[model samples]
Target: MSQTLQAIYAAKRKARRFAVQGIYEWQMSHNPVHEIEARTRADNAMHKTDLGYYHELLSEVISNADVLDALLVPVLDREISALDGVELATLRLGAYELKEHAEIPYRVVLDEAIELAKHFGGADSHKYINGVLDRLAQSLRAAEKQQAK
Candidate 1:
């Protein structure tokens, strides 16, 4: 990736860290997602990692969460209701890139998210994540084609 895109990926790495932290906190507490979200953004220091891209990406993903979840369903074969909160969050972040951020190559986004899943999610989470992202990317291409026609 060029310098500009590299910065964005670095940001995504940062965002992933924050997202994981925020999601973990949400899991541990009854505190609303918004409260957790606000806290994450409020303390830029929480990112800890050098990547500002993470800050931007996490903020955008959380900001546009509804649409991101919509894209997530088709990619997920199992009922989305079955997914735990962390799995749900991972899928949404990966889906957000596949559907909305067309600028980032789909493969790169999926790979990064899978890495996050492997590190932070359940042991099997990466498999589930990869499967969903692959399906989501294919559907996104189909949607683009239909729109073009």
Candidate 2:
């Protein structure tokens, strides 16, 4: 990749990392989303992250959590309550991208979520995250998936 593209990719990855942590904090503490965003920003090296994408993911996912869960629940092997916090947060992020960010390919959403799960969740959690998001993409991005074939 070119230097500029690599920098942008790194920034986005950092954003996803911070967003996952912020979402995980929100899930565990039920704190207000803005507060969580503020606290996360204050604690992190914000210049290295994609602040726009981080804000979008953190705010949108928290605000639309119920809707995201409703879409995810059907694809899950177990109940939503059974999901680990990290996996749940990652899945929520993926679901939000799949649902609201159609400009992003479903494959990219799933790949990013899987990477998040591997980095933050349990040893085998990426598999579960992958399964759920894969199923979600099928329905949520049916048109895109069809066209890609």
- What does the lDDT come to for candidate 1? 0.71
- What's the C-alpha lDDT at position 96 in model 1? 69
TM-score per candidate, chains pooled: 0.70, 0.95
- Per-residue lDDT for 1-149 in model 1, tens only? 69987765676677676776665464457466667767766777744454455544556666676787777766677787788777777787777667767876777778887888888889898998888887787787666535545
Please give the CA lDDT of all the candidate structures. Answer: 0.71, 0.90
Candidate 2: which pairs clash? none
How close to the true structure is residue 57 of candidate 1, measured as C-alpha lDDT? Answer: 54
lDDT score at residue 72, model 2, on the 0-100 scale: 90
TM-score of 1: 0.70
TM-score for candidate 2, residues paired by index: 0.95
After aligning candidate 1 to the native by TM-score, how far in Å is the CA of 94 from where it should be? Answer: 0.7
Which candidate number would show the highest lDDT if scored against the true structure? 2
